[model samples]
Target: MTQPNDGPPQGGFGAPQDPPPGGFGAPTPPPADPLGKQPPAASPIPPPPGGYGSPPTPPPPGGYGAPQAAPPGQPPQNPAYGYPQAPPPGQPPTQPGYGFPQGQQPPTQPGYGFPQAPPPGGPGMAPQQGYGYPTAPMQPQYPGPQQGGGKKFTTQMQIIVAAAVAVVLIVGGGIFYASSGSDEKGKQGEASSAGTGGEAKGGEGAGLDGGTEKAPADTKSKVGFQLPHPKVTDTTTVHGSWVTDKAYVKTGVYEIVGYDLAKGTKLWSVPLTGQLCAASRHMSKDYKTAIAFQDGKPSAEDKYPSCTQIGALDLATGKLMWSKSVTSAASGDEPIRFGEVTLSGTTVAAGGTSGGAAFNLANGAELWKPKADANNCYDMGYGGGDALAVVRKCGTYDNRQLTIQALNPSTGAPLSSYDMPPGVEYASIVSTKPLVVAADVGDTAGDGSSISDFFSIDAATGKLIVRISADADKYAGDCGSTEVEQCGSLAVGNNKLYVPTEEHDGGGEFGDTNEIVAFDLTTGKLVGGRADAGDDYTLTPLRMDGSNVIAYKQPPYDKGGQVVSIDGSTFEETVLMVNPDDEAIRDAETSFSFDYAEFIYEKGRLFISEKMVSEPRDPSNSLDDKQYLVVSFTTV
Candidate 1:
């Protein structure tokens, strides 16, 4: 169930309000000219037949609009007001009529009275047949005066006859124009109605049959489908769950496998060989390529490695595009670690222990590497735009200072550099334009509570603009121990930031209620108020899609879960779709003590993968005989 924000009641789907007066289908007013401009001044001539001046008086006996009995031997006069006497009892009913004589059909051709087809290729040529009424006898034509000085005087009868003809044309054209406009408006109305049929109702999912009926069968069947898993040998284990729109799993000690999202179909797999340490994978936006970090082999007995390797793979074919080995100056026992891999325009970057490296995404050619300086310039990868961000630790562990730098993605040239305020440790880059940097600022209020602050810096000069404390009352709360990993638990959206809040006191369990607090990305100010996750459910902000936040609702162990949409502006909640209940899914959480299911949203669908326990479980590993079930819930 979803809750609608309190507001004024809206109109129901009963009878639609009538169109505004004088609009479509209203009594035909004086029609405009053929060019759709205003009508000209009233014509001096009398109106045409059935027009305003000639107000359709009852027809005389035996005339067009009146019925008449036939004489002793002749057939009854044709009922001119309706269909033409049913085509003399045997013939076809001559072009089905609607209260009009078949011969007097509505104007199909352009010209006046009882329209007839135009001549084959010529414009406006009169047809062979005239109006259905009797044709006047041909009259003699008189020659006009010769070009001499003698002027020819116009006759009064001639002027009157000409004016009458003009009136007929004007009135007839007016009627046609009005009728055409009416018909067009009717068609437009029908199209508008059909187009809005799938529009979402108040607080309900669109395309869900007015939000009353369940989603279609095809959508429901997408849930609980199996996803392809890599074969685990003695040296392999699942490294990551989702990479872009596909899944990546470790197939060998140094090999990774990629699978399609919908069906567990294997797409490609690649193996890494001869590296210093374990390899880590990163994917591109299109999922067509991936970058991995390969540590260099250390010298005999020397703990620090002098070289590091970066490898790129073509995900479509599982072939290595290229690999580059770079010189490293690290000389300590601590192993080098890698950060995020990001793609910016035509450049691909990977950040790691020594520093960061930029390479051409298409050819994997090394574009630039960090300089060998005491600053230890380590690349943090590219952010929102073409700006690449890096961090350098300046002081020792007790009083460390992080210097943040913004560089051009294409050339790795430094754009701006500034050291963060004292005592603030750089966590991760949240965005680029404002250079939002998340930092862990010491513990707050004892009780093992650590405070994380988000700083918005000017990207052009690296000047501190605003600082938003994530644990302050304005934000959600203190980032719990587990949530404060690489960066304070926060998700960045366009112009907004979402921070998770623990509704329960301790924040260690799955079923506890959790809410999300939003903040303005530029101003570091709270957006709206706190968005609660209902009574007993946990609401985890998964991702932001346009103006809506996609969140998941996890009910208690045995109950079902639902995917919900929250309006980013209003914080109104709408349940998009519900996931089916599986005892195995619940038991995996309660009994085997597995983490909650994982889900990814791509396009308009949510893909969820949950571990399912098999009947015969291995004692050594809980996941030994277990398989993962993949399911999808669409907007419908």
Candidate 2:
């Protein structure tokens, strides 16, 4: 999910520029050989059939003629081809020859028939020395060109040609090996980039952000380890949420941090150029990229009070991929706020006071913007998958009417629009397939108090299916209060709606008990009899763990909290581990407003974080001392 940047093209070796006009002007001549005469036009004798020097042949038989018998008192007579015999007493050894000498051995010299010294300073003549023999006197010069000299020159040339061929082969092999290695590295990079869709396909080492070490598998229980509280300052508010099944992300005013869920280790942290006003709301399927909105500096003249921008970042590396302004002319004194940042298929979208706009996920280039007439739309929220839900405000504030519209998430084109009943206002979206909406229709007593109603409508046709009244339904008593906003969070799973009842006063400092109510999505009827969790606990539905509904208790800071698992069909409750009775843990929980403590569920694991008071409270505090304690529990 790397967003393309508009810059110079990346990666490639420049093609060898066509050898300048006339091909490097003509190749230079080869250097002259310094050790011998130039080679002949052609070799006089053909190479041996076996190539190069032929294998050696057998030596003459009878040992080159039987050894001659020696005289009575003398050493055995030296025969031809025998080891050279030292001259009688004090004389030098005889020079060796290929065949027997005519009468007596030739004068002792360095070589048998070759010159023993360099020739006089002539034009092209020089003394010759046999291979491995030392220099000595010159030999008699021949009348014409020496036949042996030509053969020697030819032999040297053959050796030179073989050496040149070997050099070329070595250089060519090195280049080929280097190119093959580069190709393999490129293929691996491409494969990793392709897996950034909905499913990440490799083990821990697969998606490392930069060169960070891979985290070990998450096997330790919740009680085995605890993460230290994150650091924050008084001026900045810290928010935490899950970005992927194995990673959780935290955002502050100017920084975003990521952590490994299994080990609770900090993976990476990125600082932003502007103040981050919104936490990450949209993440690419592969969890490689995330979208966040930032509030830019206000205009100098204060004509345009608020400036906003949307940006994308690499999840693994914390690299800022791209950012662009998504602002329009202001119509009121209040600053603009972006309600939703989401991903629809391959498109990234952001909705604000001026309607919504969609951008290409690969480049961050705006693809489409909402129509001018749709400027009245606000409070945009994503409806599950690809449906963009918004509220269209019409008329004055006191006599205003709100209309709910489902738009194409990518194009911002309206698919269905329904005007809410006279006294009703949209509260939240419970489902997307059939478009279930929870609306707060005015109080039953007509005193402007709250009375909630659930509406399930067809998304394609805007046809109403069922309207369940909160006060009249059989399970109405299960809802602690008539106000829809105070009924806790709503979760839909296994074709049923799970809702947490508000904490009720039982003559205690804090509410003692609350129950979780389940209703069939299609029939609008209770799934089972009321199931009370117990005293001193409030259960809020978080997510589904296999076939069971997972919820957690939000106990008072002094009392500890625990995670619960309820059977989706039977509504039976099972208490997981309760928080340790540690004073530090209780103080951390009480440090922040109860709302700041967040519990997130993903891939059968529950993540919880509590803000920590690192230093003593001071109203004029300037030091950045805010922090949070994080931990995880396995639900499956």
Best by lDDT: 2
Model 2: residues with Cα > 4 Å off, grouped in runs: 1-235, 243-246, 280-282, 288-290, 295-307, 327-337, 374-381, 384-387, 396-399, 443-451, 471-488, 505-511, 556-559, 589-594, 602-605, 610-636
Alpha-carbon error at 550 in model 2, in Å?
1.8
In candidate 2 the C-alpha lDDT for residue 605 amounts to: 55
Whole-model Cα lDDT of every candidate shown, in order: 0.40, 0.41
Q: Write one digit per residue (lDDT tens) for candidate 1, span 1-636.
A: 110111101111110111111111111322232112122113212122112211111112221111234578865443322233366766644443221213444454332223346558687655533221112211111212211101111122222332342232111110110121122112221211100000000111211222222233342322424443324322111223344534533232345556665554667766665321212222454554434433422245532332244556556556777766554344243222333355555676665434566788778777886554554334433442334566655443344566777778778887887677554433456544435666544322111122345666666776655555442211222222211112223444445566655333112212234466676645444554545565445566664544566666655545555666666667777666555567654333223211223455444456554322223344589666454434444543
lDDT of prediction 2: 0.41
Local accuracy of candidate 2 as per-residue lDDT tens digits, 447-489: 0112245655556666554454332111111111111112224
Model 2, position 547, has a per-residue lDDT of: 48
Best by TM-score: 2
TM-score of 1: 0.53
